[model samples]
Target chain A: MDTAFCPTCQVIQPTTGNVDYFRLFSLQFSFSLAVEQLEENYQSLQRQFHPDRFASRSATERRLSLEHVTRINQAYQTIRDPLLRSEYLLERLGYRVADPGQSEPQDPAFLMEVMEQREALEAVDLSAAGAAQQLGRMREETERCLEQDEAQLARLFASCLPAEAGREAVCAPELRQQIVRVNHRLRYHRRFLEALDQAEENISEQGV
Target chain B: MAYNERVLDHYENPRNVGSLDKNDPQVGTGMVGAPACGDVMKLQIRVDDQGVISEAKFKTFGCGSAIASSSLVTEWLKGKSLDEALLIKNQQVAEELALPPVKIHCSVLAEDAIKTAVADYRQKQKSMG
Candidate 1:
């Protein structure tokens, strides 16, 4: 069996080892991913390759079943997470992300932007009555940024991969750079929301 | 599985759970979050021009392990040089806190917070130049 091909069935098989999540499962990178549909697909795959289902099978068969199940789970997880999915896409296109220990020096412009946002967040007093409303506006702005990120991801998916044909091509360096910026912004936006949530919780507790 | 006693202690009673003034030239803030588990940690350090971390504070809205990790790092960071603080590894934190494999990432996040806080300070210095 070619590793690129879906290992579960005898359809058009791509080879394995070098296969990515996008290739392993035919999915368009979009916000339109239906949770119910995903669950259904996962359940069907579970029934097919779950190790318990193959408990009486031969050793090789059981091993294969276990491997397939792991791949399915990995695929599901990667697709379910927008950040992970973006990172995986970058990896598939041959970008080397810095290891957790290694610091990838970021662009100075991006750092300045981060510093400015952090400063803005800190300067606002969430303890004040009007601060929560201001933070709520920030949250809305962040949500809009998230939507833009999704749109950019959709564009990347549409441009990088060929429709019908499964050939993989390297994404543009410029595009990859944009993706990294968006990833960083998304990280900050998430933190901002968490901080807002904590403030709101405190406000409710104080009954003010 | 039950959390380590030390981790539980920190989680239940996190140290330095507050924010510092980001506008203050002496204060550096690092906010990081992992969307995977919906964990957010904000670490702030007051650094003098000498690059010494005089005070460290953190506020984390995460699991018990994450709280412990941040709390522990805040304690370790005070009085340390920015360089020394960045050297704090997730493994050591996890070991001291006795974090299980599943909670290792929380420790990693704390280590990241330290590095990020230092980096933020460095950026401030660079801009001041």
Candidate 2:
């Protein structure tokens, strides 16, 4: 309903800027998304707003089609990624994650654990036997942590969003804090994955 | 983003890139992370008998900006009293490096590391006395 289409005039319309990404894709507001369906919707929207389709149309209509396509692409990109989706939903619900340097005091114990794990990773000798397998196992462990973070986020979002349609979404402060915490862990896991990729590259380079 | 010359200098030739023994009574270690950028920094300082920071060391797992921030601070920490070290601000580090708004957080992380390490040292001192 919030797309570039008039009900009766059959002409492209403009967005009101209030339309969230979920509404752009005509989906419900939730962390649990059907990614395959989202991809299908994305393809259909891209086709519908293809610039070539507006070549013979009015200049205004052509511009509107381009704008629609750009917005659609952005919405798809944001909603498709689990971490980005969580952040978007949290922002929409009035929860701003702590800014750098102003963040709540983290648990020193947790920080020490992460530091130790990083140290362990750095110590892995790729030249040693079974180092590749060791790296693979570590990657798996990090991925499992990421999945658990996502699952926790899904449950938190479910509880935070309003149950009834047309009613305002009520964001509980406690739940908001929990979501922020999980989001931090998700970021850490994602970064760890990048580090693992770097290690994998090192192993390959050595093999060559 | 292209880093400024000062940032690049610190990042490329990062000073005191190592770790001090955390168990040492005179050594204070600070480990901090910025989840937004997925950066982790560890900064440590060893106090001499005169209660001045005689040495500083750091190991950072982050971008050039983050590394530069910690590196620059480690250079500053040496020879400063704990009170003087505490006075060092993130804004000063940001200004010194000419960091962009996004990477200003890197300087902030460095500032946090300093404060944390100072606090840790104080805590250890209090417990021992």
> Best candidate per TM-score, number?
2
lDDT of 2 by residue, A4-49 (tens): 6887888888755776788667677889997877888889889988
How close is every model to the real structure, measured as TM-score? 0.58, 0.93
In model 2 chain A, the worst 10-residue window by lDDT is A96-105
The lDDT of each candidate is 0.71, 0.87
lDDT of 2 by residue, B36-72 (tens): 7677899999998898999999999889999999999
Off by over 4 Å in 1: A1-143, A180-208, B32-40, B47-53, B81-87, B119-129
Prediction RMSDs, each to the true structure: 7.1, 2.0
Off by over 4 Å in 2: A98-101, A127-129
What TM-score does candidate 1 reach? 0.58
Model 2, position A120, has a per-residue lDDT of 78
Q: What TM value does model 2 have?
A: 0.93
Top candidate (lDDT): 2
Candidate 1 residue pairs in clash (backbone atoms < 3 Å) = A2-A15, A3-A15, A3-A16, A4-A14, A4-A15, A4-A16, A5-A13, A5-A14, A5-A15
Error of 1 at B115 (Å): 4.0
